[model samples]
Target: MWNLPYVFPMKRVMLMDIKVLIVEDDPMVAEINKKFTEAVKGFLVVGQARNGMEAMAQIPVKQPDLVILDIYMPQCDGMEVLQEIRKQDRPVDIIMITAADDTVTVSKALRQGVVAYITKPFKFERYKAVLEGYRHFKQTIMQKENLGQEEIDGLLPVRMTREERDMPKNIQAQTLQRISQYLLEQAQSFSAEEVAAGVGMSRVTSRRYLEYMAEQGLAERELYYIAVGRPIHRFRLVRQPEK
Candidate 1:
């Protein structure tokens, strides 16, 4: 016990802290998101923007590794900010945290290459999960010189299989693709009535296809409320037809 060596072994550790920017208009929601971000390991909130304009301004200055963006802000919308970021060819990754559950918004965000899309009224666990998953994904890419097929598969979403791709009875693949293309081209969500008119189908037929698509995970159905009368049922395509 008395004859111990003076030298001691040491191990070196490296950490990569991710810089994050929160672009949300609501103060309360922004604060909550900030707390959630902090709760996750290896993530830091570099800045906060109340609207799209502020987001655009701070993005270049802060140069955050990631952005948690929200839709429906004054001066400009989140989609506009996303487009601007893409136009500038920024390296920043984005995760949408907003109430914009409409298919159009989600589809646009996906097309813009957002890393994650989280709807409003989400729990802490859900928030934590995405941040943690993003962290793992970022680190895996940064640390690896090359990834194997299995590793690459882990990073991407599971593709639909041929057996699982079959359409429901009375739902035709050609018609569904046409409807999906129409939804993709529109700037906003539409009702079944509008979809029928645009796609040359009856309202009942369009509604049936829309609902079927929604059930198959290719489309989203949302209820839009007006001041007068009952809620309007709207549909939007969430993803392109799987090949």
Candidate 2:
């Protein structure tokens, strides 16, 4: 009798440690942020600062590759720090972390060169998604090959197609791609029943595809409550394998 040989997949090696600096007033929040950054394989937290003043002092010495900053703090705020860094011609990338829901602050932060923004009380998965997006963007920029604006935009994180996301172990690529395109065009989260109706598949089949994607971390499932009936589950494409 002939036996099949086992093939092991190779693990991906990160090129370098993506050094990070945390600037948050709350020690607890800073610790949590640090833990999350360390959990990701390629990133490392090099320094932590309680305020903008301390952050300025550490940036030159630590030379972090990225900065996770809080907008409001004693001594100095995030916007002021960003201005100072710009004046000093530092190349460190910044991602703003804020608890405030104010639109004005968000607009200013974007204009001030924050690469991304995250509101407080976010899940680990959401945090991972944004960081992964940023990583991809940076990698694309580093590539010396000529590229178009559309290609550059493609490097940024956007909603995934249903097919491009997670799928069952045994799914036809054509069908998956079609389903993904349909999902991407939809504006809101879809129920399995709705997806089935839209895709011309059975409810069970639609649900299987959605559950597979959710398991793969390519999509997110949210529960909706109704006054008259049981809660309904909705699915949305939120992530995909890094290209």
Candidate 2 residue-wise lDDT, 14-79, digit = tens = 347778999999999999999888887678899999999999999999999899999899999988
Compared with the true structure, what per-residue lDDT tens digits does model 1 show for residues 89-182? 9999999998889898888899999989999899999999898778767756785698865456546666545355444668777888899999
TM-score of each: 0.61, 0.61
Report the lDDT of model 1 for residue 130. Answer: 91
Estimate candidate 2's alpha-carbon lDDT, on a 0 to 1 scale: 0.76
Which pairs of residues clash in candidate 1, taking residues 3 or more apart in a chain or in different chains?
A: none
Q: What do the candidate models score in CA lDDT, each in turn?
A: 0.82, 0.76
- Backbone Cα, N, C clashes tallied per candidate: 0, 2
Q: Which pairs of residues clash in candidate 2, taking residues 3 or more apart in a chain or in different chains?
A: 162-180, 163-180
